[model samples]
Target: MSSVSGLVKTEQLYRSQSGWLQRAFAWCGWENGQVMANIRAGRMLTDYGRYHLSRKQFIFAAIAAALVFYMAAYLFYHSALVSIAAAGFGIIAPRFRRRSLLQQRKERLKLQFKEALFSLTSSLAAGRSLENAFLATLDDLKLLYPDPRTELLLEFQIIRFRLENAEPLEYALRNFADRAGIDEITQFTDALAACKRSGGDLLEVMKRTSAIIGEKLEIEQEIAVMIAQKRFEGRIMMAVPFVFLAFLSLAAPDYMAPLYGGIGYLLLTAALLLLLLCFWAMAKMMRIQM
Candidate 1:
């Protein structure tokens, strides 16, 4: 019995080490060939603590991409070859859609977290213990969010659970920050941990942190509003080329006939590439990283 137990422990240790090595190799870019394998296996990395797309979402995105690609190909080139080529875009579209969803979720989480900090600050100011403040903030967030499933609310519940399990407050907070994967949350947690360790006034710290986060969010909103017009213009510009091509094909098909064949196809492809590059550049310029 003792020998069997020793053998089992040795095997477990070897398997654990092997798994660690594989992950290390993946992180070091030595497993580039695994990209498609990872995606196919649904092992792709996602935003921390966020759910990946459901099967329904995947199917919907695929159908939508197919329709869009087919329509765009027919509208642009009116050739079977072009339509087939456009199908390749459908392969790439799902990843982009998934990324867009992740980004929107992150934005929502960021806003919700800011509100939660405000709630926490208020509770602390009112003489609540840190643990109680977390609990009180959950109620405040439920009022602000109204959805029990919102990211911050769920995170608060996790923190509460950990605290109830006899974990230290700072440990619970650090775990929350790790799962959040947001710089603001990480910074807040770091400050909180430091304050708790040093026996500083947490109420004052919460107040200052909440104020800073609120101000940053305000500035971000202002910047977004300021760039709204530019974003609109960029979209209009992206549409102009397609609209012009459609008009030319409709009004004077004979004149556009040359563009449908041979060297014209290459020139058109180059022009389209240039247009996409310009649109991408404009979008990057309009984006305000906060």
Candidate 2:
């Protein structure tokens, strides 16, 4: 009991020191009201862009619905069907923004996954157990990547919060997945759930998964390098026609005068649109997914 008490005291002291160190390293930056306002607007639209809405959020939704109905009626005084359609869009916009944020967060997670795999491997090799490895990797990741690393930290914090509150791990993990906005996080959380239920070697499974991710990333990098020249060529080829036409128009306006006419202008617009569409398709085709 004495030794355990001593260890707890030491941990508390160490944590206090770490907190002081972090504060010492913290930066004070300029604040902007406009930036804050934009952030607040985004938060309002998506309810902090979270997976679930709270009681307050429900109340806010009720208020927004009432406001929308008022606005729709006001607009209806001017135009009926158009106002109704516009109100319908206003109602649906928030939901679309929420889903779009989730998609963006998921893409960020996918980008971060490769780096996370290596961090996990390093943590495991450094004699950390699976849970400790996850915690340590979260700490290491804050500097290594971008906000998706913060998302991992958020998950860890959520888990810690639930444990402190005596909440079930399964419930906490499911909630964490809902907040994570990534399929891999959800899948991994499910795998953890399975391990907890079946009582197996979770660490070994994590290691194997890490190795597979590393191999997959290697192949992806190789493919990216191989296509690098083609992508560059495609971009250059796109610019060439536009540049040539611009130069020709400037040098000999009379010779290129037909391009400004009715049918000629229409054809030119169609050509540019088609060119943009083709480029977009090529870019989409080149994107390799795991």
Candidate 3:
């Protein structure tokens, strides 16, 4: 019953957020165009947590996946038709790529937000109100992140823009926290709002929060460094089989020719599926939710 309700909520969200053009494209089995309508309408903020791949990027991923799948299929069964059919798996590759990209964005934003907090604390110490401090922090962030497109810089600019337009600081902060989907930012917003409401020492709170969050981020980075080596080792282990198969095919074609026949065909297919399952399982395991 819970699963059914979850599915219903998902369905409703899909209908509520998507435009007619996006819906039409999705209904026609074009996954790449699902977010194009929103993009064209300049409503990227509304889809902040979800990464939208450009059409070219989506097509490129699909093509790359198709080529890889074709090669793997050919390695197992030297049939051109089978390899072509296997390449159809590429159509779903962009979906997984989008998920991976979203994760990357989140990680970058987390680090950027940490740096922004450091800047914010410094500005708060200089006798600026929270609103003016945010505006002042932009100059510090610009020096640290010279790239105009840096995630944190863009976020600060948005906040600054909202402040200039007389929007409530809490509303702007909450919007940022919602889009970020980061616990650190959410906690900071909640704390700031509470502090402001209670007329507490906002500067001290900012200093404490920034210090704590920085230390936590440092620990996470250390742990990530340790886990990264293991992830690399696992990738090498996964690549060995493909490398071995390719070497065998090149070094002794006659030896592998039997594997393309009769019962060998069934065996190779099972092995291929098993390998894919293992890859999927490893991917899931490697994603350590922080």
User: Best-fitting candidate, measured by lDDT?
Assistant: 3
Higher lDDT: candidate 1 or 3?
3
Runs off by more than 4 Å, candidate 1: 1-51, 227-229
Cα misplacement distance, residue 267 of candidate 2 (Å) = 4.1
Candidate 2 C-alpha error for residue 74, in Å: 39
How well is each residue in 175-273 modelled by candidate 2, as lDDT tens digits? 866765555656666776887789887677766776765676577557767777778888887667666765776698787777666687567657767
Each model's backbone clash number: 0, 0, 0
lDDT of 3: 0.84
lDDT of 3 by residue, 158-213 (tens): 88899889999999999999988888889899999999999999999989988998
Model 2, runs deviating above 4 Å = 1-107, 117-131, 143-149, 168-170, 181-183, 221-232, 287-289
Deviation (Å) of 138 in candidate 1: 0.5
- The global C-alpha lDDT for each of the candidates, from Candidate 1 onward, is 0.77, 0.60, 0.84
TM-score of 2: 0.53
**Ranking 1 against 3 by TM-score, winner:** 3
